[model samples]
Target: MNKKAKIAVTRKLPATVETQLEELSDAKFNLDDTPYSEPQLIRAVSWADILIPTVTDQVNAKVINAAGPNLKLIANFGVGVNHIDLEAAEAKGIQVSNTPDVLTEDTADLAMGSFIMASRRFGECERMVRAGAWTG
Candidate 1:
């Protein structure tokens, strides 16, 4: 890795991740923190050596095809890569990767919520509270 890859990040990530990416490559951040328009995505694909897209950024076949030959890697920031077109990237010889375990904490919290709701009958309690019938 003598030559640093020019990386384009599609959205605002956590500070730690931004720092790491900055250390690793010529990383560019989206300061606006908004999803890219289709034209902006196309331009990013053309301009960058690597593209770091979030779940909100849809990297479909059209965008992938618009990428320059310099574009080689698509390192998605989040768990889901369904927003990106796998076959398109493969066809263009671009490698695709993602953080699959990114939602582990979220999933665990959701599971705990479900258990607590069921065991305590929170739904019924909430209904009563909303109806002004809950004394407590």
Candidate 2:
């Protein structure tokens, strides 16, 4: 922790987030915003102390096994950790972290939309509510 941790980000982050990460660590960003192939991902994992990968970036056992001793953490930039190989990471003494509940709002929005579209019978209720005509 005394020295700058080498961080490899597998995908592009927001400008502000990237800047902050760079300030904190020796961050290597995916400037082109291109998804890494499995081989490329292995190389990245083999080269850094920390890895920041998106949900779509599958960090499986093979990739984990190929990681170098310097690779200590995999900080997934998404809600689910299923994409990462937890068992492999544990065996390697590497910690895995993720952004939990990051898609709560999006999930709720999708659920509500699905509910509303479940039946067209609620169309009048929807219009009435929008028009401030619904008392209940």
Residue range 37-132, candidate 1, lDDT tens digits: 889999999989999999999899999999999999999988889999999999999999999998999999999999999999999999999999
Task: Score residue 27 of candidate 1 by CA lDDT.
Answer: 87
Task: Report the C-alpha lDDT of model 2 over 81-125, residue by residue, as the tens digit.
Answer: 998999999999999999898899999998998887766657788
Kindly provide the TM-score of model 1 when superposed on the true structure, using C-alpha atoms.
0.83
Q: Cα RMSD for candidate 1?
A: 2.5
Which residue pairs come into collision in candidate 2?
A: none
Question: What's each prediction's TM-score?
Answer: 0.83, 0.78
lDDT of 2: 0.91
